[model samples]
Target: DCKKAVSGKSFYAMEGKPVCPKCVGVDEEEEEEEEA
Candidate 1:
């Protein structure tokens, strides 16, 4: 996992859950993809 801060990069973008901007570019994970 990325250790970079994604505060202003994607603050409150997905409800109240804060996601890492570094990992945003990665789409190899099918975890949330299946649910979405």
Candidate 2:
């Protein structure tokens, strides 16, 4: 699970809020591509 977070393969959350740094990075990248 930790490895997945580090690699941005999955996201972690607490109380329904995202807590994984890598997931945020991956999400941002996806959003940028979508905008493009």
Candidate 3:
């Protein structure tokens, strides 16, 4: 997992692996807005 700990926020299953919300999509969109 990309996160050190699961904070019980939420997650999505990626090929049977748990991935955090940010890792899935949130962070990338934010980063893109900042770049723009």
Candidate 4:
């Protein structure tokens, strides 16, 4: 889905547009907590 992350970065390009987790309400801190 749009949540897909490239490498460890929070941004990527899709269909010539920039996509970010934050735009979809994905918190990076929460992801780190879940990973831990």
Best candidate per lDDT, number? 3
RMSD to truth, every model: 8.2, 6.6, 4.2, 7.8
lDDT of 3 at 25: 62
lDDT of 4 by residue, 1-36 (tens): 454545675674556666675665555556454542
Candidate 3, residues 1-36: lDDT per residue as tens digits? 575345765667777887777676654233435542
- Candidate 2 Cα outliers beyond 4 Å, as residue runs: 1-7, 21-36
Candidate 2 has its poorest 10 consecutive residues by lDDT at 1-10
* C-alpha lDDT (0 to 100) for residue 3 of candidate 1: 49
TM-score of each: 0.24, 0.24, 0.48, 0.29
Error of 4 at 4 (Å): 14
Tens digit of lDDT per residue, candidate 1, span 1-36? 344564445432344455564455544333455534
Model 3, TM vs. native = 0.48
Worst 10 residues of 1 by lDDT: 6-15
| Sort order, lDDT high to low | 3, 4, 2, 1
Question: In candidate 2, what are the lDDT values of residues 8-28, reduced to their tens digit?
Answer: 444557457755655444453
Q: Which whole-number lDDT from 0 to 100 does residue 24 have in model 4?
A: 57
